[model samples]
Target chain A: MAYLILKDLLLQRNMMLLAFAYVLLFAFAFQSMGDEGQLVAIISMVGYMFVMVGGAWEEKNNSDTLWNSMPAPKWKIVGAKYLAIPVYVAFVTLVYAVVSSAISLLQIPITTAPINVFVAALGTIGVFVAASLYYPVYFAFGYTKSRYWHFILIFGIVALSSMLPNLFPEKPAWIDPLFEKLPKLTGDAMFLVVAICFVALLVAVSFLLSLRFYGRREF
Target chain B: MESILELRNVVKNFTGFKINGISFSLEPGYIMGFIGANGSGKTTTIKLIMNLLHLEMGEIKVFGLDSRQHEQQIKQRIGFVYDDNHFYEELTITQMTKVLAPFYKKWDWNTYNRYIHRFGLPSNKKIKTFSRGMKMKYALAVALSHKAELLIMDEPTSGLDPIVRSEILDILSEVILDERCSVLFSSHITSDLDRIADYVTLIHNGTILFSTSKEELFEKYSLVKGERSLLGENLRPYLVGYRESQFGFEGLVTDKAAVQAMLNGNALLERPTLEDIMLYCTRGRAV
Candidate 1:
């Protein structure tokens, strides 16, 4: 199983390098806008392309028939994907750390310690959770073959959902107070809890979806 | 001994066309030629047995186990080579084998290398750089390296030189000697099958025409090139298929001895080839 996973990743080194290049470009773009935002974008783009589309692209590239010929269990194949996300995240984390250290050492104001670092890590997790939840939907819908349409559907929905909120705004209540008033918890603490729960919920949901979709697939 | 594979009432449908109720079995230590033309459901039936394609309605048993229920277990013992070249183009032959070897529990690296040398494939060249024959030899090498009990090949010799084809057939024959492994080799090239195939299965237009011994197929059937009146309605049922022209009538009939005994003239009873069967069978059907 490990061999299968390792081979799957290694065989597509070209695609991985391409994905890495794309992520780097996007990260730099985000950095120019706001260095704080770059981490999230870098993590999301890599997770989506590296972890999600990796297998999908391989299948479309006609490696699916070869993979299907192997004797390994389907769950082992799925588990390999689960293992791969952290490996990709770890790679991103190393890059983020190196950039942050270099910027701070150089006395560059662009690098913010602790808060920026924490947000970046959380954002990475948030993106991981997002891809984990959504990739299964892509798989269920056979997105490998229908990638052009799926690309539109995924990004278009994201664009529309964020934009549509202006048409119907909700009023905020009086109890929307700052942490300074209560001396109880900070905004950072609230974000921490939200990120953990969101990520955990996403992982659980993705596993359930995989089991559901996998049952019907002939391969 | 039990048969290596058995398909009982295996029915697969794609839209309106149906590969209807294909039932045949191959015993251990035999080379079974799955003879068919293009789109004759040879590949489809192989896919169904391999669990690459789902059976619409049928039971496929491989080595006495239900194929659907125990797919992974079944796949472990079966080595498959498809009609097309399907290896990663960028990877070298050595690199590709290194990647695939770990997936099989019974993979013997030494044996794989032996076959590689035997086939004379270059060790370091990228698969994309190899010619058609080299690519096929590489595939066969991969197929043979793993300790596979059953080899299911679909048109493995479509467009290779006669020498390369002979090399492949020779290796296949040798593979059978080791463990009595059964081979289901499908091809349009009857000469290869005739030279090596112990048993034969003929499929035409989605359904199997006949599945029997190679000797029986050649020995029983003959190409009778005579006149149309010689083939009367009384003898039409025995005639598998025929073609007519201004000069005379030529047809294929099974039960060659009966035909020869009936008409004593120069009713030529030539040895029927696989292509002859396919051609005669084609003539019977309306175009």
Candidate 2:
């Protein structure tokens, strides 16, 4: 598994470097503007791409049917991609913490909470959501073949989802009272539990689906 | 009788087309050639044996273990070299070598280094820059580096230069020197198989045409060339298929003694090469 990750990292070294740069620049921009949410989103997107490309390499698009012919099972193959996501998230989070911490100490409006844990936890949440949405699609169609279109499609999904509350007409007046009180009862706990459940379900389903698709695909 | 790999009544259906009941078994120490035309199931069978694709209906056993039940364990004992080369395009050969070596338990750096020298592959070069032959050499080198008891390859020499192709065949010959190791080589290039294969399994339209010893195929089947009018219905049972052109008729005849006797004092019966046999066997299916 380590070799698989290392091979894929080396395979996409330039893209990885570029992704890091993208996150760094985006983090700098958002942190400088005191916008932590957008910074987390950018870092999350970068990690998602890393796992997506990893999935593509595992499936082997440009090359011949070499990896597909290797004797590993469908679960181990999908498991490799999932394992890489958190590692990439950790790396990106560490980098963001370093740069953003400096900005926070300078009174640049960045939060000064117990830095490592808070940053890692928040970045992991974003990683979880983005991966939950992206992995199922990426596994459905092996990565390189669908990266561009799915990236665009995922953006549309994110945009439409974010706009739903504003776009949809108002719910009943009594419903607002429940919506307001719901946050009081749960707050981040609800979000965390829901996100964890959804991500777990998505990852499991993607793997099962990938295995089925792979069994039917020829070299 | 311990066979390294055995396929029994393997049937895979792809929508309208089908691979029906293709069966063959490779003895422990002999190299078996898998030959077929374009639409034949050479690669598909390899995939099924490798368990890359699910077997629709059949039983496959590898090293006495059920292919589906112990797929990975069987895989660990076998090395596969598919037609296309796949390594990290961005990684230099050095990086690829280091990263891929640890996956197999029997990985040998010394053997890998030897193959690199034997194939004349550069460790510093990125795989993306290597020529087709070079890439193939690297893939073969990796496949051989691990101490695998079985080697299953699909068209290991199809597009390579003759020099490299010959080198791969030589390597396979050496690999088969061990009494425990065997190979299942799938190829369209019958000449390569003819030169190295101990047995031959010919597949056509997803069906096994013949699975017999290479020497037996050459000895039993003879290619007869003569005038169409000179040939008669009496030879129909022996004729696998025939091509009738403006000049005359040519085809494959399985019974060498009968073919020679039938054309006595007339035409001639010559031993058919693997190519000649495959050509005639697949003649009717070309359209």
**Given the true complex, what DockQ would model 1 score?**
0.51
Q: iRMS for all predictions?
A: 2.1, 2.5
lDDT score for residue B271 of model 1: 87
Native interface contact recovery, all models: 0.58, 0.60
What clash pairs does model 1 have?
none
For all candidates in order, the CA lDDT equals 0.75, 0.76
Query: Can you write out model 2's per-residue Cα lDDT over A22-131, one digit (the tens) per residue?
Result: 76567655544345565566666777677666666655534325555565556665566667777788766665666666766777654433244444566676666666
Candidate 2 chain A least-lDDT 10 residues: A110-119
Each model: TM-score of chain B?
A: 0.94, 0.95
CA lDDT, candidate 1, residue A115: 31
**Model 2, B20: alpha-carbon shift in Å?**
0.9
Q: In TM-score terms, which candidate is top?
A: 1
lDDT of 1 at B134: 89
Q: Which whole-number lDDT from 0 to 100 does residue B180 have in model 2? A: 74
True-structure lDDT of candidate 1: 0.75
